[model samples]
Target: MESDKMIKPTVSYHLFLYREELARRNARQLRLSRTKIDITEELISRTVKNIKTCSMDDLKAVNRELVFKRKLRNRVSKLRKEAKLAKQ
Candidate 1:
């Protein structure tokens, strides 16, 4: 009777941790998926077409912003890769 009580509580505690970790992993994946849509090849080409046809200053501003943003993204990606290598 005593071992049964101890084992049941321990198992329940581990199950609780497992559920918490699964929830966290799912939330992180959801957030990353949203980021993927904003920076795609299709979005780039569409932007270029808009810049050609668009006279609005705001649209042109967005095009220039994406240009510099891509450069920054490249540097950040390289740094992240270097950090990952250092960790291993």
Candidate 2:
């Protein structure tokens, strides 16, 4: 009986935390959405096109952008999965 009582509170706490996390994620997703996904791809493509021509700073900047692009893609995919889970 004690275990059953503990389970309910734990489950409620889990859901509460999940909801709060999702809310923060959704907000970030909104900001990320401002830029089209393709923009990153295009930027990478352009960077590659100018690879031999780019200065060290340009290359470093592009590298940083590439890292951000991966992070953005991962976050978007995660948000999609969470949305699907919420539907169920």
Candidate 3:
């Protein structure tokens, strides 16, 4: 009878701790999910704002400028590499 009483309280204490841990984990997961949702919403809003601000032609012109700059940058780097090889 004494052992049974001790065992029952011990089991109950462990069960309580387990439940508390599970609740904490669940709360943390819920918080993280909420944060993810907020970030995604912000990104979508920013993308929509950008699309609204720029006309199609403006966007195309900007893209073309970026492509031309990239090509020029690549050419410069290639020239630098060739000069380095010639030195060696």
Q: For each candidate, what is the lDDT?
A: 0.54, 0.66, 0.52
Cand. 2 Cα-lDDT: 0.66
Off by over 4 Å in 2: 1-35
Query: What does candidate 1's lDDT look like per residue over 29-76, in tens digits?
Result: 323332332333335555667666766774766666677557656755
State the TM-score for model 2. 0.59
TM-score of candidate 1 versus the correct structure, residues matched by position: 0.35
Which whole-number lDDT from 0 to 100 does residue 35 have in model 2?
Answer: 43
Question: Judged by TM-score, which candidate is best?
Answer: 2
Question: What local lDDT does model 1 show for residue 37?
Answer: 26
Model 1 residue 10 lDDT score: 43
lDDT digits (tens) for residues 12-88 of candidate 3: 35455545656783543333333333343434444456876878875675566556555555665666677689799
TM-score of each: 0.35, 0.59, 0.38
lDDT of 1: 0.54
1-88: candidate 2 lDDT, tens digit per residue: 8886665434335455545656783545534432434456657777899899999998988888888888877778888888789899
Backbone clash pairs for candidate 1 read none
Pairwise lDDT winner, candidates 2 and 3: 2
For model 3, the local distance difference test gives 0.52
Measured by C-alpha RMSD in angstroms, how accurate is candidate 1? 17.6
Ranking by TM-score: 2, 3, 1
- Find the 10 residues in a row with the least total lDDT in model 1: 29-38
